[model samples]
Target: MIQTRVFPGWRVVAGAFVCMLTGYAVAYSFAAFFGPLEAEFGAQRGETSLVFSIAAFLYFLLGLPAGLVGDRVGPRPVVTGGLLIVALGLVIAAHASTLWQVYLGYSLGVGLGVGFSYVPSVTAVQHWFVRRRGTASGLAVAGIGVGTLIGAPLANALIARIGWRDTYLVLAALTVLGAGVAGLLIRRGPHFYGLEPDGEAAAAGKASPSSSGFTLAQAVRTGPFWAVYTAALLMSFGLFTPFVHLVPYVRDIGLGSGFGVLLITLLGVGSTVGRFLFASITPWLGRRLSFALMLIGAGVMLVVWSLSTSATALVFFALLFGAFYGGFVAIAPSLAADYFGGRALGAVIGALYSGVAFGALLGSPAAGYAYDFFGSYAGAILAGALLCFIAFTIMVLAPEPARWLTRRARSP
Candidate 1:
């Protein structure tokens, strides 16, 4: 009788999941803190929104270096170190005496920390599974949804009871404890253990090839790379506006603060469902089409959001938008892997994400400023919808990678 060992790659996926959940929970929790921080510092809406924007920009931008470093050094040290930085950032923000100090601590500290942690952790999972790549990637990033689901309301409740300053202290402690333990579960790819991807056994004295895909330089030269990058850039311009502004938008319309938080929570619920739901269908729908649909769906939902005024309409918009947004996040890494292959995948994914960094840097803050100028979020919301449609058009026009096309042709 032959005995089969449990695949160890799932453990890596679990670790990545926890890391994403912890990091993004802290990141998205910025919404819950927004009003309090404004009150504390006497800052305007645009200024307060900048804090989230700067942090989002840094983390995504930093993903490039972090991914490069992870490619060379492996993920464990990089992820663990990043989490520590997150804890430190939270701690610094807890004791901040001024708005700039919050920026220094939260924006830079959290940004750098999440940047170091997110890409490495996510990219590590790509090297472990081929057959279930979509599922694994979705499961891994679903943490973002779960974190958002929990983070906003938790922060709101905590702030109500313990106040905002001490809430940061509490969040700092949780980051160190939760993400730290999960990071320990991360290891190198299956090749490092004398095995093949998807838990297949290697022949005696042979390990899976780790150098099977495009090098970073080669990947950058390809048309598919630029297409994906440009599409991601356009999609992101409106992608994160809701995360930073949705709560305030609800409140501005006379819905209570609690209702605003509830909308965010519902968004999270929709996001988690979308990740799992879309990933489950990708093998049948094809990555390109599935991803394009996510963009279009999100665009349509944003249009609905822009028009929403009543609580019921807003609630309906939140769930669907979250679904599409979550699907976009879940599918992106796998799509990159399909296009570029796994060689230097961390760096490849990171470079692709740089598009998102620039868009996010401008998007959320611009939305806030638009609101300030117009005294309504309608213009910014509609603009976000337009960007999403443009992104979808780009994706639809972009050709599939030759390698991916060949693979599909060869398949039954």
Candidate 2:
């Protein structure tokens, strides 16, 4: 159980928000430094993109172990350690002269920190709010958007004024304060605080045999796991492709940099709203149904994106499509927790996100190659639409976590 008992429930929520904002927010802002890194390091687009991919891969790759550690040792050390590593990575990146060094600092150091902080935050917060699980998780992950909102522009401004190297130093110090300090505060089970998880001020929490959820081994073997994995893979496949191309795509189509940046920001806002709002609405809609519907909606938007050109159309595309994609990020993990237990929640979500890392590996380069091969993004967008449809079909077939709970409840 979480140890500190001085604060109320909302305080926990606020802490979760701050931890997330610090952990994810600072790392995300690095994109604005991309041009500087490329100019200074003489890296190609593909190579620079891999820095993101590698960091992402490690971020998810370390998830399971972090989850196991969180379960056994409690989330506090994991989170605190993660924040420090992330902070160090930024500092290291600031001084690095080579592209490989940048990869080391960002992907290995900072990426590892993300696992320590991100998964534990989600799982721990899950312990705090059950009936309101959707909203709680929504709020927690919403920091990604909030972070993106604040981080993106700040990073851009910092890079322009202070140099990317100095910007990293400043951001690192901030992360140390925000994520590092907040993570040190995380407690394991809510019971230690004299309040049950989802009890009293929280309200209506239950633990069934089904609540044992899936062990990591069981999660690997289940059809439901694969179904969820496929859905996530497809969502991520479609998600990152556009991000990789957005700025260039707009410029290629003759939209000004100002407009291009606005469209990208719109996407972030759309996604943030989608994460919070769609997640809040998930219980009424049901998880699988909600995910499936979002998949279809995102697929439709992909088609729209392929045809869009004008500034207004691009902004609208980013707004709507971003919402669908962001909404998926918000809800997917809680869905995992509902199906699997909170015991290995970090690892399971980590593994799932690892698959998303693979999707990013596929999405960005594949989109680039496709454009080169076919001489158009048209083929690539069409391909993503087909994949999203397939993911939708899989979600339709997958059983709900509620059914799993009921089955366990009825058993001896």
Candidate 3:
């Protein structure tokens, strides 16, 4: 009888994908919930938006500690704990009677919860695969795009049928069910199962080389680290601004509510395609070049988006921009792994990803404030394009860490 073997790493990838998809779907559904929250609370755009910014800030900011915890204790516990906390946060938000309650329950709770799980999932995928790390990471993170694709329309439909509160309850249930299953399946690298990463026969011989690289302390001091960190921060500014504001902007520009939700879906579809497309070509173009080109593409698309006034123009912009944006996201984890070693990837990636926190803090509310002050999204959109261009420039010019370059030079 012939036996067929299933690689455990693929299971890890599947788990990460489910966790990311469900977590982001529930988290980003805030866009669909935005109008309802405002109507119920009688708050302005900027004020109501504080909840999401605070949540995202906590999510990205706390990812460092969460990653550290995952590094020390393992991913299973971290993901499980996060899933539970997210569920509780949603339940609390559903029952909240005051804006402060919403902030406390949803923003802080969900923020910390998601922070715990996000990096661990990404890091796990990196640990599981080497040659195909970009593809695996891209597949896992593509969940974010898929979540947005399904989540936006689902939330809108739920809001129309049942109330926003009930919609959140449904989301909470789904998040728990989906992520809990993932938590059970996710684990560290092949070492835990007494196998090698990628399950290759020669992986044992090359293991030491793969694990060699800067520790967290040493990595932080490198120029490449700062360059990537700053570029990620800048990228986040443009990336998240649209996630928070696009639906509202579409509405403001006279697209009906239904079309607004569909636009979000369109962006999701574009992003999904981009993530897969970019990741697939990373081996050919190299992560650095792939990321730089995608960043530039996104920046150009954002500029085009700003000129959009009609639904047709906006649709074109969404698909193009979303594809580029997704490509950028798909590359980040693999890029970090390339620049730094995979040994301390959890900590390094977490710290690098904190740029998302800072950028989200600035971008979302800034767009809201721009609208309130200027009565349009033009200025905010233009500013995001500029930031994306700046990020593209930084990524293109930055060299690999000197230590990494030296290591590569010394390698036979």
Candidate 4:
């Protein structure tokens, strides 16, 4: 037997880091392609946005099913499969000559791959960590920002030098490499290793699986589920707006190409720091409170973005904004797990992301069309800020899981 005893917990956390690199970097980086893709495919700007929205729709829509598959098939194959599909999507995007072809390959194929890949990796992290859950989740998902940071600048550079198609051929190779390493390195951790849920000999203690878990049906029927999902929906709607457009928006305001690239990348830097900060702070504040605070912080940043005229101010804005947005990503799954059980955590988390899908549906095209409509990003910024406030409210009002879990633990 391949023993989970073969390695320490931190190693598994390391594996999660690699897994996210491929998923977030390549899968979500399609936003950077908007300008090139519109030109290369001879499509309208909105048509390009449609490609991202559809992919996002598939990303969210496919989460629960993929989670179910992760549970049964085990995360290994699902993750490896996702990486392979991402590579395939890249190759297909490289060869496509029409808008529909790009949509079919990129939106459908890569998007679906994200659905398959992301949760397995995330769930694996959750499965592994119990006491330091927030930190583990943060480190693992932080790859989303790091990979995104790498991909955007690299994609931009490649687009300038090699053209988008050939550039994708190179990225496809990297995608394959990323998946292979994950498959090789990430064996199921403590559970597979025959250790207890928490490490058996840790400084603190050990844990068993929660005796409580809601059936998928039961989870879907609740007020908390809808509230968290709604908040996430607004998050995706507005969050990716920055990921997809900050660079272009910077340019639109006369910062020029290089600064625009720096601005976009800066958001990623903020995201990285934000993830670490949330991981550090969540223990003190609790997951629900931390999430609410992040939402509020992000919403305020959106307002700042809407009104900025100077690059110096904008850069600072990108930093703080990136941090909190990154924090949201790291904490989200743990919050889901805290409220729900890991039993349906994947499915529920995936379902929650469907809001993100809806957000993607609206955010990308709306931003593009806003640019198309008013010749500035102001409309998009205002809309995102308003939605962020809505997300904050949803999160604030959503039921706290600790309340229920504490009651369950103490009663009888």
Best by TM-score: 1
| Candidate 1 Cα RMSD after full superposition onto the native fold (Å) | 2.8
In model 3, where do residues sit more than 4 Å from their true spots? 1-4, 202-210, 400-404, 407-412
lDDT of 2 by residue, 1-412 (tens): 3345444444556666777778766656655655677688886666666666666666766777777787677777777788889899988988898999988887677678886777776677776666777887777777777776677677777777998889989989998898655765566666555565555532346553213567788788877778888787876777766655666577678885445555666777887899877886787889778888888878889989899988888888988887887788778877887787765676787777777767766776677667666667777777788788888899988888889778867999
Clash pairs detected, candidate 1: none
Local distance difference test scores for all models: 0.88, 0.74, 0.82, 0.78
Model 4 spans > 4 angstroms off:
1-8, 201-207, 210-212, 408-412
Residues 281-326, model 3: lDDT tens digits: 8877788878888878888888887898899998998898888878
lDDT of 1: 0.88
Model 3 scores what on Cα lDDT? 0.82
Winner on TM-score between 3 and 4 is 3
Using all chains and alpha carbons, the TM-scores for the candidates as numbered come to 0.96, 0.89, 0.95, 0.92
List the candidate 2 regions with Cα displacement exceeding 4 Å. 1-9, 201-211, 369-376, 408-412
Candidate 1 TM-score versus the reference = 0.96
- Relative to the true structure, candidate 2 reaches a TM of 0.89
Task: Give the range of the ten consecutive residues with the poorest summed lDDT in model 3.
Answer: 201-210
Error of 3 at 46 (Å): 0.7
Full candidate order by lDDT, most accurate first: 1, 3, 4, 2
What is candidate 4's lDDT per residue for 1-412, written digit by digit as tens?
2345543556656767888887777765665676788777677666677887787778777888888787776778888888889789888988998889888888877788878888877877777777878888888888887986777788878888998888888888988998898776554545555565456532234444522376678788878788888888887777777766776677678887577677767888889889998778888888887898888888889889888879888998889998998999899899888888766666678778777877887887888887877788887877887888888888887767889667756989
Candidate 1 residue-wise lDDT, 1-412, digit = tens: 1134668888899999999899999998898999999999999889999999999999999888999999999999999899889999999999999999999999998899999999999999999988889999999999999998999999999999999999999999999986677778788888777777888877776535455788889889977788888888888888888889988998888997789889888888989999999988887878887898898898899889888889999899989888898899899999988887788899999999988999889999999888888888888878878888888898888776555558646999
